[model samples]
Target: MTTNRTVQTAADAALWLAVHRGWHVLPLNYGTKRPLGGCVGCRADNKPDHTPQTCPCLARGDGALCHAVWAATTDPEVIRRWAQRWHTSVWAVHLGVSGLLAVDLDTRPDPPPHQPLNGLPWPADEPPPADGLDTYATLAALSGGTVGTDTFTTDTPSGGLHLLYEAEALRWKGSHGKPRPGDDTVRTGLGWQIDIKAYGGYVVLPGSTSKAGLYRRSSTTTTPRPLDPWLADALTRTGHDRTAAPDARPAAPVPVLDAQTGPARYAASALRSACAELAEMEPDTGRNRKLFRSTTRLAGMALAGWIDRTTVETALAEAARHAGLPAAEIRYVLASGFGRPLAVPDIRSAA
Candidate 1:
């Protein structure tokens, strides 16, 4: 088993090293993708969040990391203290927070059975042309650029790809970016499988470790180039145009509810709970991406007879708008979620 001390030491080194090179770092809890918490008094009783604290004492001593992204910093001391406090942490740079962006590409021929890629662009029966799924080659074709230059790249343990590029600005332009179901931020001309991590987002730093496994710097080149504008265009454009959804839907797990009330009803109740959860997230700050993941699971419940399609759409549309999503964005996001396979917990199982 990994001990906190050993993990913390590695984390401290990686974060400081990144900061030394001018990258802002947020130390997330090891094996998870979120930052450490503030004192108990300030945290949500159930879920974790990244919000600053109001208490003068804590605020004066250390900025509350309750809002994970807000705590992003280049300050060496603060990072060191955080690492020491949560020894089993890993590094996740605040993308677009420090003039950095990442191009995440999915290279897997087929998504792992357990981790389906929801909302694919093609119909379930008609998969992408064998060539369409080639991440690196397609990137070059769409972006009019090559990944051959001396740029920093990380070979993700999940068999995915991560390439680091220098952005001209500190963050992705908020006015131009809209979230897609894959947590990809797109412009009008971006392409499929190319996830743009810009402002209001985070990606594991190249040297980080996670439950997924260690992320290794696979390429020798350390210098990065400005992201190719064509690539940006493709990331934006492709995200908007795709209409096909996934065919990953499967029968939901049977709910283990009291027989008197019926197990199916329990399943329906669970779906409603999920719908409420997604609809409550703030869309202006990464809501659409999360909506895709949540809805994918909820869609399974609907197919399982726990909820109706109309009810799901109505509840989702209302919530999407509340999160500041526009109509087109909402529709695309919903369709993507519907196409995805259900991946949420069983309501009866919760009991």
Candidate 2:
């Protein structure tokens, strides 16, 4: 009887639902958050330091997962084909890449006696996941409506829940566009483990399998509520630790767009525009590829002498901060997008 619930069927259903909503969808690796790596032949083809962007596999006929995120599309038939080929593949939906939001409410952090807390990597000092109930209650009251109660929700594999909402744009200021690995600290309304998967973010979609179990959707509230003004403001408020540290690391900086002349300044303006566009993109599947294309365009502009190297770096830094994806991943994404190696400091300034 259980074979009826094959991973392929669940993933296909998810793709179909996402496409119906105009949301781009992509396949993820089973029991893991990352996408499945390309087939063995593609891996062997990669040079010692070759990254995803430069991988010729993506351009080849068999490059199925070579460029995972870029393959996200709204075409129903294409989605069906992918579902058919990648049977065990789980599905993920990129949030904020398209400006959509997923408020993750985990099962209360109350771990069972002698049993670990459900698998979420929340900080040690945070409140139990059950408190999310209270947090949502608070938000719903602040919004002055019952919309929260009826909003779209999903059951995560770990026995937690995902509340789906639409945002005007990616809201939280966390991640400095450089979210780090093992870092699920992306902000949302106040509460422990209250996660905001938006703006260059993603979450495993419903109807997928994981080590925890199946990611199943519950009875959903169809209408998406707009970001309430109060709730929006609350989400932007981060605690002290979550704030940017004063440091020598690459920080989000205002690009050198003040000047009205010079090739570098013109490049800065163009790059800034690209950054802004990237920032406003709703989080959706294919976001990694979307990031690649957007960042690649910026890199190309710099190489083409349209913007200064420093300005390009600054633009990327700021955009990465806005994206809130892990900084390490950004490194790979940039490399993959460039089709070649890129060292921030090595980029030469234009004359």
> All models: lDDT?
0.58, 0.56
Tens-place lDDT per residue, model 1, 4-41, is 65466557655655666666677777656777775565
Can you write out model 2's per-residue Cα lDDT over 79-127, one digit (the tens) per residue?
Answer: 6776777666477776654456777765555422211111113335544
Model 2, poorest ten-residue lDDT window? 111-120
| Over 4 Å off, model 2 | 1-4, 38-71, 108-129, 138-147, 169-189, 239-351
Off by over 4 Å in 1: 3-9, 39-63, 108-133, 170-189, 235-351
Candidate 2, 209: how far from true, in Å?
3.0
Stretch of 10 with least lDDT, candidate 1: 112-121
Q: lDDT at 297 for candidate 2?
A: 66
